[model samples]
Target chain A: MVCELCAVAKKEVESELLYEDNEIMAVVHLKPAIPGQIIVFPKHHYPIFEQVPDKIIAKMFKIANKLGIALFESLNCHGTNLLINNGVAAGQTMAHFSLNLIPRKEKDGLKLQWEPKKASEEELQTAFLMINEKSKELHPDLFGREEKNEELVEERGRPKEIKLDKKKENYLLKSLKRLP
Target chain B: MPEEEYSEEERKAFEEKIKRMSPEELKEFQKRNCVFCQIIIGQIPAKKVYEDDHCLAVLEINPAAPGHILLLPKEHHAIMPQIPEEEIGHLFMAAKHLSHALLRGLKCGGINLFVANGAVAGQKFQHFVIHLIPRKESDGIKLELPQREIPEDILSKINEVVQNRFNELMGIKKELVKVETKEHAEKKKEAADEEESEKKKEETEKTDPQEEENEDEKSEESEEEKDGSISLDDIASVLNGGR
Candidate 1:
């Protein structure tokens, strides 16, 4: 519900529509956490950042980098935050996906409020171990990516069946609540 | 009119197409029209390029190369990011086969398989299509990737950033599979679908940050050669012309 940005056209008023193209739109965030806050948004309204295709995501950054540099030069800012909130639980107030460019200056008095929760040596090791095992358990089918085109041609001959596993489904739901 | 204005007509036409779908409808667009979906349903028609129980591939009508095809799941979903570890392996295995087949089918050169997710990345259709842009040296296929040397430290940071994103996608995949709500599943998938592109961006950034900068600078002078952009011949011409 939050990706109202895509449907919006800046009509040379209200907020500045910095850039526009077939794949994404770069617009000035009306409520700038910093004076030059901009959001590089994909034209399509995908709910989470990952669900959108990879190519578009790549291009968005390519443009964003350009804009980031422009924001750096034009605004003469110190640092920048290239951020996207993934899900509702992850402080994602809006369902629509986009990246935020928060330009930082010396004394604007804005901070991310990130307090480090460092783990002890053993705890950190165990955490790393568990995550490593999870990494090894990777399934190629996990992302539904196809590597080549001939297979797509060959696929022309097969029947489509979308599969969803119940156990992992539950595990995933439980996991989202504690997203790191 | 603003000084650097884009076309309003194109944007409006584009908007009309985008608005027709509810998110639920958008998710189903692929399942309903996807060749794999059709193959599963025994609808439409296709010449199978490759197949396994979990995934498959088919020919693209409008091919970027001679053996252009699409590799996808037998079960339809848009560009999803995180998948089960096993499923990720299988998908890669499917890709391996397609790469070989592509070698067989095209007979000439390299593979440039990529997916364009959102409209901003030029995903002309809503079906989460991956463009398996096959490249042949003779065929003049070249990707317009900028080449530059990134600082090793910066590259390391980028690697860490991508790795984190990759994990985030994995988590997202779990979330999608769990919810059973089409919206939830689709939403999570959007984030994962983008990983390939982002990783590639990092790759490009690593290889040549200057390429994009060069392309942008040269756009005005070489508008004629731009359509024929990303060709080895074009690169050679530019390289030779530079000297």
Candidate 2:
């Protein structure tokens, strides 16, 4: 199936391009969030943020910082915002992944606020404890007494499947089915 | 165009508040709503560029310019502050090279790097990403900010709540208990030796200690307290089944 970004990167669709290398492409947004807003994306289609490699992500940021500097110097904008929309819930429109770089001036009418919400002490502790526990599973090298065995590192990305004897499987299925 | 400026400290505090949400919350928030994951797994087609073991770079369908690119890690991370610190440098290094290419290739005046962390911050997608926007004279782009005033009491209350919660989560004010353990002593000795060597290297190379600390944070080891009894493990495990 044809993807819009794929078409642009492949030159199947005409675009006013800025830069292109073997692995990435930069283009001006047709309907930019702001006038000087630009969208930077990988040439290949990677629809989500979590699955992209670290090195490539680093490269993207390095480029972004440079662009940010350029915007400050050349465009005369006071600052910039590096924006990414990750999922449908976050208001991501395109199926493919992209970042929006928007130039900023003083009092330009964008309002990004973190209005505080009240939470009970119990709720606050629950939040803290959940992250505290999860951090152990996440960074064993830091919190846990034991190091992450080599076995775990080798199994980092791939999904794991559990094997059980038929009797055990049947028992498990029965128990789960009995849940109200 | 209007600029909304916050002190570095304020920005950090805001980021921390946003990141206070657990990873599970982010994961639940994503829930197969990711199109980028599909591309990585080769379920969907995209224009190919650079690919490595950890991340990928691609072009935007709706171009801000000719060479607009999006860089991201292969792993799905929705929040910016929650990303592993080590991975951050990698993303920026690639972006630096791309900026140079743009400078040489495009007829642009400058570039902008924009990131929105949450829905309130104009983040349309749940994925964590950075944008590179090129700018020129009379490009007509504007980022406007409207100022607001909060009552002193409300502001102080916000500060008290966030600060108190953050301290608890990070174990900032927990009194250090002296529990003499052989393991603790051995680790301390080893850490001292390592620090001595690191100091010597710093003397010779004049490397910034701050950068090193940032990198170490990614590995989850910190300089302050190596293995204290009042650690996250103790706090987290206690709540496991009780909640």
Candidate 3:
């Protein structure tokens, strides 16, 4: 079966390619939920989110963050949402995995919010126990590994230098710059 | 109770004060006002699920679904753009693992990994968080993002602007790469060169006659089965005592 996203990656489909590297690509969504919605995905076809390797997932999200910031700066959007629908039940339509970075505005008529459904204390506790137990089992290193001494040394040192260019500097300086 | 209203002059004074504050002072101020920071520091209580050096995951008090989790960075960051690349990578790695745990524990079909970066995007808090919402078929939670018909001219215009801005950001990243140690850069280049030669070897192997087609067909079939294993039909059947 031909994957639509793989076609997009190969430039077989008409997509506005926003960014590309060896492992990933970002494109303007052909049918955007919002005007500046961008879709970021791996160039290699991964059928689901869980199948992607850890390194590529990390790089994918890092690039997604950059693209989201681009939406903020270019479109003058009020905000952005990084959304992943991991499976069909979660509303994932395509077989290939991707992340949607949607530009948002106040009262934009996008209904992404859900009313809070209160679960009972007993149910909550049961979920907590089951999930916590399984999580610990799955990630033994995260739970059982001794705290590394290097982390403390790094924290005490001066923070990592994140050099911001002049444009970014202006954005950071104005607290309410994006706010109306 | 009467609502206390600030005069226009008072509001202007507050804005001016904020404008005059340095970035560090701004961060400190945001930290003080942030509730998630309090939760991270153990000043406020939370339903903690997982903790590591760089992040903390807690069960959402008001959840969209059972086993819904909020994954947060330990340090205070107001938005995604403010976070460094490495930290962003670490947080998502943790998120992936947490999603795996939810799928196994809750026996759910899927998970929604969501991040709202600003107030307009439903970011209720100042701190950064990734919401891991467990999902099953026909769960009442709705995330409706309706696709509207934008004019051709507008679409192309947006495409151009976003492309230019993304290029500018990439330029900034290139500058950051220049600061890496020479030794580290050399190591990366060496690794890339090795991988390129290995890829060339694989391409040569793929040119063989009948064996290549069979191998390709087998790999494709395996990939299909792997994808089909997580489909809703299979999960639904499992839920219906077919497991």
DockQ, per model, reads: 0.02, 0.05, 0.27
lDDT of 1 at B101: 38
Off by over 4 Å in 2: A132-180, B1-243
Q: Mind giving the per-residue lDDT tens digits that candidate 3 earns over B143-210?
A: 64566665554555566667777778877442212122345445655665565567667775554544
Give the CA lDDT, 0 to 100, for residue B174 in model 3: 28
Interface RMSD of 1: 21.4
How displaced is residue A87 in candidate 3, in Å? 1.0
Among the numbered candidates, top DockQ falls to: 3
In every candidate, how many clashes are there?
Answer: 64, 103, 0
Query: Which candidate wins on lDDT?
Result: 3
Over A37-149, each residue of candidate 3 has an lDDT whose tens digit, in order, gives: 88899999876675677778888998898888888887777889989887666777777889999888766667687667788888788889989787777656554444653
Measured on C-alpha atoms, candidate 3 has an lDDT of 0.74
Q: What do the candidate models score in CA lDDT, each in turn? A: 0.46, 0.50, 0.74
Off by over 4 Å in 1: A9-15, A136-180, B1-243
TM-score of chain B of 3: 0.60
Q: Candidate 1, which CAPRI tier?
A: incorrect
**TM-score of structure candidate 1:** 0.35
